[model samples]
Target: MTELSHEGERLQKVLAAAGVASRRVSEQLIAAGRVTVNGVVVTELGSRVDPLVDKVAVDGSAVQLDPDKRYVMLNKPTGVLSSMSDERGRPDLRAFTAEYPERLFNVGRLDSDTSGLLLLTNDGELAHVLAHPSFGVTKTYIATVTGTATPATMRRLEAGLELDDGPIAADRARVVGEPSRGRSIVEVTLHSGRNRIVRRMLDAVGLPVVELVRRQFGPLHLGTLGVGRTRDLTRVELGQLLTLSREPGRPRSGIGAPDAAGTAMDDDESDSE
Candidate 1:
């Protein structure tokens, strides 16, 4: 067994960089004695290892440094779970991503009922940063509500609403077009990632959401990506996202807003109850 060396990276970090898990989870695995370094079980959180020289294995499976990182965007369809697998064996992204060799997880979640752009990647650090609320990464959604949005309601949405969980507010909210009869299209933007936040916020204001679709996340926009399809983010798109995640409160440009007519209801899939 190789002795802990100051020159090498920490064991948890090495595990995270190897895509085993996030740094915190990796520490738990180490504490559980599931990780072995140089054929010796390492249960210490402070242990270090040289990736090039030390053989690391988790659950007796050798961990290899994954050099080919993937960043993919999936137009998540309604009725499909956001998770990689469902305990009840319901549909999930696994069916869509089965062909890809690299194991990837969603950066943030979109409820099974909602659909839009969802990012998947094997880069744990980037995923952590993007998902953290402190980063202030903006998410844009177009909601089809059952009632027309009045100017007063728009003001209230911007000011903030007291949901069951806590106080929440949208950064921006606007009516997409003239309300026809009872239904209206609303555009909302906010940095909060609370579960079903968009739906909850509208519900707080008496406007129940009929359909919701996330059009943009940070600097990446779901431009013309058909439902149930997945594609790689462009190099420029990935670079901008990384920059946005690293530096919070930095102003980003050219994040296109959702078209007024292209609301979630436009999709062919039926909304889940």
Candidate 2:
């Protein structure tokens, strides 16, 4: 049992407010030795914690105590720019974010033509690390390309290719099915954050992309979320992302200037796709 300070809200009450469980169930969870405060086992009932200050976890997964933080996943549709606002007056993410009271900004970016999972959040720390190319968060895409993707092409993609910007390689690549009607579906996974990297890599391998959709980002997946729709991240998904953001070798600071919505934008205008 951990000692509680005289100040702050009750531990179970905080957990309940965080939507972890009801106040009764939260007390039961604490009594079961499944909760921790500041990395210490905190089984004592009636323990107090500053929701804004103390780090809390249940079953080794961090709990999001601050209510101000919001994590949203949007299945961005094609023809929409990843930016919240586009100077050219093109369709952008403003329509998706309009419902959320918290000012949310995209974590990274996707090209106007590519579509799928896009993360919008007000959590600057997680956004900074995930969007930073140095951290190397993996993204998976399903692309329909103009040519048949043979095993040789898959091998070449995995083996790597030299692009105009630099040398790049897919962490994983494979054909989803046999080619038909002059096009094939190929899945590629890479940690690179370069602009239009998937399309460029496939083109280098002689498979020019006709259509592309991101299937996954880090631990979050597009799942069944429809295009042009958005949903809040589940507690488990958010926990996984937070863990990834704090992994070893993550930079403590330095991404770029925060936009109006408080997201860290990379110095390079086109680093994300």
Query: What tens digits encode model 2's per-residue C-alpha lDDT throughout 159-268?
Result: 98998998988899999998999999999999887778888899898899999999899999999999899999999998888767755688767654357733355412
- State TM-scores per candidate: 0.67, 0.90
TM-score of 2: 0.90
Q: Which runs in model 1 stand beyond 4 Å of their true positions?
A: 1-67, 248-273
lDDT tens digits, residue span 1-273, model 1:
346677788999998997778999999999998988866899988888877566677776666544576889999998887767665887777877787898777776777888998888776556666665555678889999999798789899999998888999999999898888799999999988676778888989989998889899888999999999999877567656654554535333322222221111111122232
| Stretches of model 2 off by over 4 angstroms after superposition | 1-3, 254-257, 261-263, 266-273
Reference-based lDDT, residue 251, model 2: 79
Worst 10 residues of 2 by lDDT: 262-271
Q: Report how far residue 110 has shifted in candidate 2, in Å.
A: 0.4
Cα RMSD for candidate 2? 2.6
Among these predictions, the greatest TM-score belongs to 2
